[model samples]
Target: MSRVVFTLALAASGLLAQAPTPGPLVRLYPVALDANGQPVTDLTADDFKIVDQTKPQTILAFHKPRNEPAAPHEVLEFSNRTSGVTPHATVILFDMINLLDADRLANWKALDKALPQLESGESVYFYVLNLEGALLPIHAISPPAAGDKTWPQGVATGFDKVMKASSHIRQAQIGAEEQVKRTFKALEDLANKLAAFPGRRDILWVANGLTTVPDPMLPHCNGDWVECSLYVPHLGVTLAKDRVAVDPYALVGNISPDVNYNMDQMALLTGGHFYSRQDVRAVVNQVTQGAVGGYSIFYDPGPDNWNNKWHRVHVTCERKGVKLQLRERYYALPDSRPAVERMKAVLMEAFQNPTDLAEIGVRTKISPLPDGKPGVHLDIRIDPSDLLLREQGGKYSGALYCLVSDRSATAPLGEPSVLDLKPELTAEQYKMVMKNGLPFMQDHPTSDTAREVRVIILDQNTNAVGSVTFSVK
Candidate 1:
């Protein structure tokens, strides 16, 4: 069988058979900064007051956001690092899709001068959104090899080649209204990739102007420019779901304040700042500050609060002149069938997609089964903290849905096999789980011809995902 679904008849694991519990407790990551824009490192849970729909809710828990590297995992291991609560990442998207010729030149020349000066190993990323509205990576999210040029050096030396190649791939210009739609779509897709990773994600959206994102709808809104953007609430929810903050930076100097009101609103709505004018170095500085130096606070929105509406969220800090940035709004509606269908689509896509998602950190071990069947035994350990657990009665309850695909089977696959992991933990069990990791062990039958096995795991509460692909030895 070529490309069959891996059966998840889990080998009698303790928690795999339990019924899944209802999800509770929403989490938010908000950035706290001083008047001079420096991070406030010492803020505690008592220092914050979270409001939902004009009602003040008590802060249940909070943690200062930091990049804590994980302890070593097993060999041949792949980790998404969701469990460690990795520090924020910054993506610098040079928006050639919207910039004019003159502005594009000025934008890149500034980049050419400032890129090489970035500290050698900062977590800042670089990409170019081409005229076709397709995203191309200028610098991948990996360390450079020894004796190899860094991305900054590469950009400084060969910036023209990058720009030319991106332009050469352009098709017929997508119309103004379509440009707006596509731009938002591309941004949402980008956010989904970052969703699997925890902590804040800062996107430095570099464009001189993006007035076309809603060209057709703009004329109908009278003078309430931001009202149209508000109705397009899915974009805001997607950013918030992924814990992403958008920092809109002007591509060229002296941009008129009236040019891109929507982006400025986006910056505020997502807890990121809008840059009116800045050189290349300043852009890096702003993005780094926005990403790493921040805080993550979680609050219980009460049982009656999830009433499927667009709820406004605001955070207030007790310290004077300490500005707070967070996603101000989110749609409370949780889709029914679409979510299941979406994960299935993603599982199918994982076989060919180059990158594996890390929002839900996952580590797995594969070994040969001792039985006569020519299959492999799978052992999975997930970062327990990444699961959305709620304490009810005397137990902590949460669940995970796992999907696996294998092309190396003898029979054609049927509807995908879903593995449900609803762990039931008492106080002692929960403590043990926190000390060790969450484990899911199963024996999966594989064909001798099996080449690769792809697994996708997701938290049912938030739909945060992590995936890994391992070769059959």
Candidate 2:
């Protein structure tokens, strides 16, 4: 992945504060297949039970896939929903980084033959998992097409580019250890990107299986300290070194377990499926034909301590002869600075992609600044209620982290700003703030060549993000 550098500056505002209390609600996307391996869509909330850490939890809401709008509207509406378990779109991820040359070619051939069978009303996205561990979107096929028997022109063009890029991976001289790291990094990045989209995304991962872990004894450890040895002169002992053997397959041995676990977890968490060296054409056909069925179950797993623990989840149905395909565990994110900082880093990495994180609602306006330094006055409006806030000393408080970048140059146009929302307001002032929304304005210096401006905002309390892009003419 590429690094996005930003110079951050704090704007004096009242909202700067610590994290808020953890919220309720843990959502799960589970697909139930009968003895025949077909989706059981008729199951209701009463027919299902969810166990978190072996404790039965109430199912607060359940949504089964239903008829939705076609094409662009369907994509737009699905992405915009505040809550619900609707089927979003299918993202066919070609993991070229992990697949051997022959497997890559075979999977490519499978996809080539299966593209024409895509459902006309479904939005399907194509991505190539590059060696750098990024799920790069090549093309998106929306609905209302002439027929299901053909692919859009863009799909053909994009697939060609994807194949061309992936072909080089076959010749690239990357070791198994490096490959393992890149593959999982790609999966992790892909999950974060998909989280912004509402509803369940069927990720048809096409690749040979990846190593679940990488060897800790490998030389030039690539920042993986666990695999790096530490020589302590005082103790006269080398820690974390079993032997100095140049075993090419060592990476595979170390990573295979983790790769398997992550693949399964990724599928469950994203409400997708993992297909390892399977008949890609058949899987695509099955997915497009609606042969697979699932339900989105939302429930409150209760309050979390944010101690960064993995909570196990088990789902079963009252109906007999049904097999559940779902993620077995979910990690509770750490509330500490390290974890939050890591999340911020991940969010910054995702900024390089074309998709904007619009999970949180936001509106922006930009006008030329009067100072005449090729600058613009930017204004943003955010609803206070949409944010998670804590009350202390008779005042509401929150923090907002904002980033403004020149997309044309892929550089920060101005220092990133942090706005604090500590307000000890009177009853009338509180009403006004709630009624009118929290408003923020800043002047940013821009170059004459800048064609686009990207603004990203992160809610410190909830970690919710909202982003907007403006074209400069």
Candidate 3:
């Protein structure tokens, strides 16, 4: 519930995705106010500045303080794709992965009590980190009335519910290896979920905030490892293989590091707010009441079809003396290149198998199926083949993995399809010879017919060698 304002030295690049014509660019106004937690309705548009990087961009439009009942703010816009759904989405990540502090712990309890009282009009997704440190969508709620279908009272509240969920998960009682996959899959589900929604949305992340983990310098490991924790006291860190060992009373938040980048980028690019894990009371109050009645700025950088690049956006107050708060920036839709280009540029460096796969090839498909919902339907299939391992002498041996990345610009999205290709073969490879792959529901296909999907692939060692943009659309 705490607020964080990051003022960065801007850098310039022509990396923005091609945006649709100027209209209503989803804008989140960070209303700065006095310490009393009241809206400073006196501020006007003249008190704000919009900057892309260091260079200030003109604020195309602005609005004064408005309430929820003041006519639902015309924020929704349509995209030009086959379906007119806007590609905007956001998430509020409740980072409870390693909170061990008593005070912050109390804050979390306070939040639980406040959630029912909080009010919001838009549909935002709630994601939490399991004991294993994997992010998962616990539930997606639409403001006040549309609470969780299962638990109409709403998601769990209090330390017991949160800790119990973590304990059960840690004991391998639930969500095992799938925990890691959830880190990526949660995003994918969110993106697809957003696609199902009508307009653009932003993710608002709330946590005990971020801090550092225990380092070897501590009496425990003796310089062998580092400590990881959250931004506030009373918040503890969750260890992968051990129970709580570190004390939260001994830690404090640092600015240089401790901030979670993965969570940051996920929300930033999609036009979401990354609420720091500070002042639990303030954070809870902020989330309950939408924005603080600040300046709502909007811009249309021009149809963003390419869903692949990290675009940087900045907002500055044109008026001096008045402080301005906004998300660090936003990432644009990805580049429109075939899968190969994306792998070479982004995926290859991280995904290669250790042994020595010199090159890799990828294929993808999306199958549509009938669903109760009305929207694009998809059953995604990714095939990774033609892997060449690094040759040691005359013998070629190594493990290869094929990963399918499902990410969309519209939602808090991600899903990774990893295929272990240790034994490679041709289309006539062997008995049952189906391509080793993973299938996921991409979009709920209109009919029962699935659509062929296109995916970018990466080799363990080499960059992108080839891509399969196959489709049944």
Candidate 4:
């Protein structure tokens, strides 16, 4: 589903005000290993230092190895609150866009052989990038049943069928340029979806390799006629020299430099690793083993210049004989859109994969109104402490954005609502808000045919999102 509803309740309401753009808060997932290449789990924040562009940055938050249990398949309902709290998720992406037919088959066989070795509490999702550029989820195998330790037999069979079908479809489509574009876009989308999860995320990209640049013949032409010869004819102009012919099949067998750069960036930003041309068995083994534990470090790069430049980050340990792996850089400029507008964009993206985000906690109740109106009463409660609020001029200020939608009709029930909280309260009142939580109640018209209701909530101050889906009964 492309859209999900988000609901938020704040203590106070006022006109929405634009806050100054703050520097990006960069979160890194660093893996420390000993000489034997075993994961090192004993390191603390004081033992490490982060340097950005040669400037030292103070670590804002540090989390130790967080290894939580994976949600079971039987309890994996998308419309429930508890199902959203996945601590770790691993996506095994089979890149059909960049792999040869022989390599694809070999990798598939290798993954098939290694599937049974997955550990308990490991949440693994299998996705394939087809020729049409869709990142299709072929199968998901959560922790097996209580007594059963092996991968589910039915799930494995379903995966095989889906993979075969996807491969056939991808093989029939022509043109490498389109494939490259689609693959990169899919990777970016996946990264955004995973941003909502507050745990370790590993993307095991199994492919031949990636290119950093698309085919020169199919260069991205953004209004420059010289660069986009395809537009020359439409512009009533022709080149004196013979026009450079575009061989659609020329990029069919080769990777580009741009693709390589894009893939590497996605892996680093999301605290995941990238692999290419590796044995499927070895890749699977590494992913399964590496999923055990990792450290998350948050740092705020103070006062961005908005120069829109890439800043390199170097993290090192004070202790000797330990190697660290983490993302190297992040952009300095913030999203130019207003915070509320950005929140809406984030909400739309989160709707594509609602379960990926579980930062904010919420409870929702829906009941038919006793007045016999053709509508349902919606009550939503949000923990105030979960929101990132700032105290300004003796008042606590925060912002919230909420949306409710009908999944079947693919339309919003009403215009999105924004709550700008600026409550001037005594210390006792503030404490009460923290303890009792923010509660909001509203009644909205509904249709009998609408069987599902999706709600999405966003804390504009923090950009943390919480989403829930409920059956209309």
TM-score of each: 0.71, 0.51, 0.38, 0.58
The local lDDT score (0 to 100) that residue 198 gets in candidate 1 is 42
* C-alpha RMSD by candidate, in order: 6.2, 11.5, 19.6, 10.6
The top-ranked prediction according to TM-score is 1
Worst 10 residues of 1 by lDDT: 1-10
Mind giving the per-residue lDDT tens digits that candidate 4 earns over 1-473? 12222343221232333433233456666778778767777788898899988989887556566343333323223323353332455556667776777567766666665565555323556677776677776554232322243443334576678677877773556555455456556655554444444445555666665433322566654522222332222111111010111101111233466555545554454344555544544554555444344665666676553354445678899879887766565445555775545555566755655342444556667778787987667777665645655566766656565556554544434333343333344566668777655667666566766656666667665555677666665
Judge candidate 3 at residue 117 and give its lDDT. Answer: 49
Measured on C-alpha atoms, candidate 2 has an lDDT of 0.52
Compared with the true structure, model 3 gives a TM-score of 0.38
Cα RMSD, model 4: 10.6
Expressed as tens digits, the lDDT of each residue in 1-473 for candidate 3 is: 11111111111211111111122233444545545545565576576656553455554444454333211112221111112111122354454543434444564565565445434423434566555656555555333323332331365553346656665653343333343343334334444333322223333444433333442224443321111211111111111001111101112233223335534533333333345544433443453333434444554443442233323456655544554444444334333553333333334432222111112222223333455453333333222222323344544433433443322322112333433334443333332333343233334222223233223344333232333333333
- Candidate 1 on 1-473: residue-level lDDT in tens? 12233333333333322423224556677777788888777777788888888999876545565456676767656555524444556667788866777787788777677778776535566777787777777665442321233557666545577787766774566666667776777677677765543456778888877653432645575433334543356777678766788888885655665766766777866778888666767766766665455775666676677675667787889878888877776667554433344444444544334445655567778888796777667787776766667799989987677766565433223334557767788999888887777777877776666676666787665555677667776
C-alpha positional error of residue 243 in candidate 1 after TM-score superposition, expressed in Å? 5.5
* Superior candidate under lDDT, 3 versus 4: 4
User: Per-residue error at 401 for model 3, in Å?
Assistant: 47
The regions of model 4 sitting more than 4 angstroms off are 1-14, 18-49, 58-85, 96-106, 116-123, 127-201, 208-270, 274-304, 316-325, 331-334, 347-356, 365-386, 391-398, 402-411, 422-455
> Could you tell which candidate, 2 or 4, scores higher by TM-score?
4
Instruction: Report every candidate's CA lDDT.
Output: 0.65, 0.52, 0.36, 0.54
